[model samples]
Target: MPPSLPFLLDRTDLHLAELHAARLDGDLVGVGDRFSPADIAGTVDLRGARELRALSLLPRLPVGLVVERRTAAWLHGAWAAPPGPLELCVRSDHRVRVVPDVAWSVRQAVLRPDELILVRGVLSTTPLRTALDLLRLPPDDRYDGRHRSAVITLLLMQTSGRERAAAALHRSPHLPHKQRALDRLAALSLR
Candidate 1:
């Protein structure tokens, strides 16, 4: 028999056949491209947006990649299902060729030192930076309206999220969709 999988293990060494078998046995459920214990999802274990499993997500992400956008938001307890393709940002000077199953959303950005944080050895954008990125994100076919709305709502729920985003917005006058984001924040404030 194949070696038993760990409770929340979803690493490069995992085999497709093993994942399929675990799914067939009702012991695991698919999350993005990984398999997680089926019981933990809806049971008492699941507490709000920060699933216990999410703590491991950052470390499990491929090394040297800077996670950002919806993926970073999800990592920061947004809990809204992130894009199927892991949203990755590489340094403007670095070059990488990723071939994720659904294709990764990769970009080259020069993130400021204050905009990044290391979580469990994986690097990602700060929550505020992630919020800003999502707020200004151009619409994509990968995310539907509901998903975006849900992600936005969860973002606003973060500590001082609304205030911080507004302050940061005024600092950068050249950003696209500035007025639209202002209006959105105003409308969200009323609710």
Candidate 2:
């Protein structure tokens, strides 16, 4: 067996010092600072806590929303220019109201509760919902025809994994929009 690596944080108490400092300040500081093993002294292991903090707090906040390519790009801070419109995918079971300032459209579908996951702090619709929603968007709402087609195709593939896309489509008296969504999905499949 290879020789065991030195327990730098455990042996040197460096992680404890940093946590104490951060707790006193009520914020993390020098989070990315590198310290040589020589900089720490004592018998204390705080590496696990340090690792947890590094894993949890330093990254971009997760947005609990079922997003498409455009929304994903925007959420990741990757877009240098304004996106034309925001397309959001939501479950047919949830009540959603779009805010006025956002230029957006919705694609509605059934999402299994088990598939929904928390992003950041909000609940996001599942991948299956994302795909079905893409299929339900109007052609005019999708500015780039090729990109739109690709998203729809991807959603259809996702749909195939679950069951026939048509299996979820049904007339809804409570949800007239769902009927429109089903019709749109059917129309797209034909083309």
Candidate 3:
């Protein structure tokens, strides 16, 4: 079995059939593809469970891809469920290629050095960067429906998440949707 952090079970810990059997046997309860011991399931923090669930995907994907956008927000304990087609980002100048036969969606983004953070050994965008990315997304885009809640969660999670994101938007060199991002941040701040 692969090394594990506290309160998480990965595929390497058991085969799918074995995991399901354990769940059916009332020994474990699953979140996405990972599981927590059944006895502690109700006591574990839901947000932390979600974070661990999202992190489980990391071992299944290639080594170099950085988690971003909705997925990162989920990792920050900002979403109720794991992201579908698991979103990831490759730096604009990075050579990482998307792996096939995996359930993930990849985008190329220009990330600043400060945008990344390592959580439980998983590399992902910081909540500020993740929220800013979602806020900067075109509001009219069809796929952005859940982005509002995710962005709100990301911003509210840290004491200065909103301020940091607002500052980043203000200092941006290219302003494709700077106003939109600021507006969204302001609206969330009022609530």
Candidate 4:
């Protein structure tokens, strides 16, 4: 028989009470019998716990965490991963919120989950989104050519964006250089 999965618990301080309340309300879903302390503590709030429980209740499939530009940079070697738990960007109220793993702290942005995807175990922003986000950053946040090329290549391989990519570049408010990149990407796709 397969080894039994351990029980997980909701231990995150901000979500503990909320998780407990959700459990009482029957709103939390999960492999209830398999909750471990680590699972409970990792959540940032009751809603997060509810979401986790819902995810856990699904047929257990390996799903990578979704990430954004900064997190992608850390995962891709442009920057070092922080010592503590990593944060992820989630959409809410027509804005993005960066929620820390242990707290309720969040920073708002005009981003959405549709702009991200999973790549090689890391959640990375979609190529177009990455490029757009990068364009908004100062020179200090720019990636080297190697990383930029890699991001473009992966995005092309993963999405059907021959036209959308071009349009995104054309409409970008940040990176004027994107037109050249878009032309190059389009040419490469035709080959």
Deviation from native of the Cα of residue 17 in model 3, angstroms: 5.8
List TM-scores for all candidates, in order: 0.67, 0.37, 0.77, 0.38
Best by lDDT: 3
True-vs-predicted CA distance for residue 56, candidate 2, Å: 14
- In candidate 3, stretches whose alpha carbon ends up further than 4 angstroms from where it belongs are 1-7, 10-27, 40-51, 143-145, 189-191
Question: What is candidate 1's lDDT per residue for 21-71, written digit by digit as tens?
Answer: 987899877655566677764463323224443444655465567888878
lDDT of 2: 0.42
When summed lDDT is taken over every stretch of 10 residues in candidate 2, the lowest stretch is: 32-41
lDDT by residue (tens digit), candidate 3, 1-191 = 98544566767877879888988999888765687778667675855665566556657566678888777877777766667878787888789866665688887888877889877667789888888878888756543547888887777777877777777887886867889888877877425
Which pairs of residues clash in candidate 1, taking residues 3 or more apart in a chain or in different chains?
none
After superposition, which runs of candidate 1 have C-alpha atoms over 4 Å from their true positions? 1-5, 9-18, 39-63, 92-102, 139-144, 151-154, 189-191
Q: Please give the lDDT score at residue 190 for candidate 2.
A: 28
lDDT of each: 0.65, 0.42, 0.75, 0.45
**Which pairs of residues collide in candidate 2?**
none
